[model samples]
Target: MANQTPESNQPSNTQTYGFPIYAADWIPEETVRSKIDKDQDNSEDVGGESSSSTSRSCIVLAGGGGEGRSGIKNVIVICRVDLDTKSLAEQPLGRIVLGTDLPYRMAVHPRGGGLVCALPNSCKRFDWESIISPREGDQGGEEGEEVINELKDVGQQLALAFNQEGSVLAAGGEDGTLRIFEWPCMKTLLDESKAHASVKNLTFSESGKFLVSLGGPLCRVWDVNASAAIASLSKEKDEMFAYCRFSVDNAGNEVLYIAANTERGGSIITWDTTTWKRRRSKLMKNYSISAFNVSADGKLLALGNMEGDVLIIDSTKMKTHQLVKKAHLGLVTALTFSPDSRCLVSVSFDSRAKLTVIEKTPEKRKGSKLAGDVVVVRVAIRGFLLFLDGKGDHRQRK
Candidate 1:
């Protein structure tokens, strides 16, 4: 794709001048009918299996390009391969067309039924309609119920994060409160004290006993069963402007990690959940920290910055391990580790993502830089690497 340099003063352009624009081209209408007919015939001949299925796995993405900027423009199913692959072997799923009034956020529910989407306005309740439905005598895999109607009063985006295990869902909103919902029945089990600001992120501990909320400068840890704030961590004498993100260890120990940047600059703070003890503080330089991730095993911590540097730290020793400077060309928006902790992945605003396998190295490479560190050693069953990127594309790292 050719990079375009727009005039600095282009009135309607939201991007900066000299920035590379990234958008899928609208298919030409003149060729639509013939392509549809050919695709239909191909599907019928193949017993409903898509041709791309002969090659790679596919995932659908939720984003813009629908009608009026709010309508259901189109759903894109990418036949994605690992970035290193020369070609992908995935198939495309059929697109469900809708008017320009579709929700801003759509989530695939844990129950494997219909999804819950957050629509415009303060509307709550999931507008659920069937999107994919399993057939008789069929085992549920890709086939599942689809969503059609809007469930009113479902709450806003950024306030909720599902556990993806089909058991628990946590939501917080502008009302400065957090609510935990149990699956299948979808009832509000617990509602905690009001937060300091609109809750931006709600995360559950690995064991699902605790919920970490990122809102104001102070990050609050809530007990899931008791439905109360167990601990709140903050910087001394600072206004609550939290860019906080958290993760838990395999033992379900809560670790609240916060990053804030202003005229006074930023620091990455790590707190122990059980005692609410401030374990360690790292002073940052040159760039502001953007996002962070803690490994499932709780040994490694990855903090990404705006300057594209990803500082991999040793959780036990509280020191830096490996530093991938300019890990991504653009702003790093997301970071995630595999279930087994053998690899890591990151997504960026630069319109590209990276999957880096945690190479097993000598013990010298492991502990020499960061004390008592253990590098990822082996692959999981099925030879699949556990790294995951949050950019709508979830693929097994080979």
Candidate 2:
């Protein structure tokens, strides 16, 4: 669990819960990095870059081709920010071009050792240093013909995830199989076909003791070492569970959350890990859930709906704490909290990702909604050009 900081700077959030319930006016952060736009091979286009900077976190965004883009393939964008100024670096860290197929899941190593992503053909790992600062004539690990000769015969790429320690990576695909490899080494460990008809998502328990896979007909929890199923769930109502995760309790117990889109909309189901039995089942929304993620500390869960709305749920109570409707022009594709729990980042199919700060507030429990006051604030991306404009000539586009 993450340590909670003092909330003395803002008023007590006893009225609206701790959620940044309101979207304040947007303000852009000042940056010292330059931006770049380039065309390559008359086949694909690449965008977004940073000049240089010292920053604590970088966001990796995956998007398919868009306007003024020639290729149908997915493009990778890396954005680095000062984190202190709550602003972007003058430029981006870098970008990776994966041809023809749409890119999906991405996993960055905790120690910055490497990055693993689902390519159009295969899931590949790359050294971070190589990606950020490539040598002349080098395209990193997942670029060009280098990746073509590796990670073959796996069928279509589907899901990707790394364990807490980043020592192991798991990937699922169209072949109803699951593959686990040892870190940057990419050594084959367990290759189990029949993990399901096809896995919609892949995840590891908090302790990395169990691997969970969700499918249309069944969900299985596997013992990582033995590579065997410890528990299996088949719910008729939930034809599929596209999203699931393992969160920790105060006593350090792992709690499992599973959700799916039903006929009416979506259903959220949770299980007690110790008992491996269903704990709660509830209809969360009238629209299908597109993407959702739990905070690293397991305190908050942010869910996006097909209608482009985002709802913040209290992890403990499994109830809505705040609602931000119409969050995106199109459906949300991904949303998760920064490692420090200070920022919530969300990306959409519309080819955009936005970052919002999480302010300090009181902890609210289940039952009747608590009346609390929350301080709402909104900050724009792209160097936050609005707020710090004309302050200094430190900002420019490359």
Please report the candidate that would top lDDT against the real structure: 2
TM-score of each: 0.60, 0.71
What digit string (tens of lDDT, one per residue) describes model 2 on residues 1-398?
01123663222111111111111111111111222112111112243323223334565555555321553435555555345556533333555555454455666565554555666567656544344443344233443323423356566657777788788878888778888877767777778888878877877998888888887577888888887788997776544577888888666778888877787877778889988898887677576888878888888888887677877777777777777777666677778777766677666665445565665556465222332212112233434665567444556641
Off by over 4 Å in 2: 1-56, 66-73, 82-91, 134-150, 236-239, 363-398
Candidate 1 differs from the real structure by a C-alpha RMSD in angstroms, to one decimal, of: 16.7
The alpha-carbon lDDT assigned to residue 200 of candidate 2 equals 76
Clashes of each: 32, 18
lDDT of 2: 0.61
Evaluated against the true structure, the overall lDDT of model 1 is: 0.50
In angstroms, give how far residue 142 of model 2 lies from its true place: 6.9
Return model 2's CA RMSD, one decimal. Answer: 17.6
